[model samples]
Target: MNKQIIDHLFEFWEQIGKHGNFLTKENGFSFAKPTNGSWPNKVFDLTMEKLDIHALCEEIISEELPNSIAVPENEAIKDLLRSKGLRATSKIKAMTLDTTNIFFGNIDASEFIKVGSPTEAELFAQVATESFGYPVDPSTIGALVDKPGFQIFLGNHENAFPSCGMVYLDQNGVSGIHMIGTKAGYRGLGLGKKMTQFLVNQSIENQSKEVYLVASQAGERIYTKMGFTTHGVLESYSLSLH
Candidate 1:
């Protein structure tokens, strides 16, 4: 498979896979997306050889993930890319682990989950702003909330509302812990550590093969304590949507 297409597919997956509609327009382009959740990270790999863009698009939509919309702009580019033979795919890997000798406590996630949506991108963003301290807009958070495997665990109190952490399940049967944080007042009580383990245990209960995540430098040690082993790293590249 094309690495570029796979990378785009992984981005789409990370964004909830609903964004597939965005790539269907004539000007929009993608290489490969996931079919039914196997190796979800594979969706982000870019192959070296360039295939017929239009034919590739058709093949991707027709075979890989057929939910693609029918738009004039997408059709035109499909034809053009097919002629150019410049196929792009992203390179990435899947992470996994076995559920043996794991240490964690009950998730108790639903206790703090007051507002739950199948995929509430708006609220997800609001909670992230307070949790991450970076004032992220809904548009940016919406992309993540829409991804295939996204779940939010939050804790709220008077004058303080923070998202405890976020977890997702990929097509590869590996669960991922994206971001985990607690409000200033809620720190030092082990909330951050527990939430991380909660998601890991949850994945194991669901029969997931492994759990993976791109952790911040400081957060790496937290995952390490929870029986998570790090073998390698994953990086991101963009082509300037402008």
Candidate 2:
């Protein structure tokens, strides 16, 4: 795994912090959007080095933030989290794609549209929540798209929004695909793949040299088939207040 890519992934989270409150310390950074019902309202890019886990956990608990952390998967961190009564919630694959070798399946390009305005952002968020079985605030989505180097693409089938994906391009030419999803009813139509390809294409056009994403279990197969290979794992832990 390239350390540069890993660092950029963290930087991507920092970029996300721009739309809301952000706090950075020696060990890590925390983000929160109290008005936005999104998952990023928690700490990320955590490193246990030179830090006090107990104090950090207490601070998070006292602040009433989501007791969530994303860090590299390892026994030491796991044990530390366990000591704090945090349990693993998910193990995400860190996958990268060779944007130059990306494959685009046979899908109508006309069905895909670039999300640019608040209305389109709302539609994209709605489709993403429906596809991924999660809740996302349209205002957050809209604010995100308004940032530089962020692009959202949506798939419109039969004049209805069914799938969506996003790409982040940083100044360092690092790109990442985030929140790709297709509605359950429209799964077999390959809209997810199409939306992914569209984002990849956008990344390449933006002069991004490398593109990556944290893949969910269901998305691992889709990304692998599209020429992405797993480079590392990110473990998510949720600390129990009790």
* TM-score to native of every candidate shown: 0.55, 0.87
Best by TM-score: 2
Tell me the tens digit of each residue's lDDT in model 2 across 1-242. 64555666677767766664443544544545345347455566666675578777777778645567776756787798888788888878888887675535555668788888989988987897888776777877777876887887888888888888888886677888888888999889877777877787777777776788888777788789878888878877887655
Show model 1 residue runs off by greater than 4 Å: 1-44, 51-97, 106-110, 118-121, 133-149, 156-160, 237-242
Model 2 misplaced stretches (Cα beyond 4 Å): 21-28, 101-108
Give the Cα lDDT of each candidate.
Answer: 0.48, 0.74
Candidate 1 per-residue lDDT, tens place, 197-235, comes to: 776776676666656655555665666666655544443
Q: Which pairs, if any, clash in model 2?
A: none
Candidate 1 lDDT score at position 231? 49
Instruction: Write down the worst ten-residue block by lDDT for model 2.
Output: 20-29
Evaluate residue 151 in candidate 2 and report its C-alpha lDDT on the 0 to 100 scale. Answer: 81
RMSD of 2: 2.5
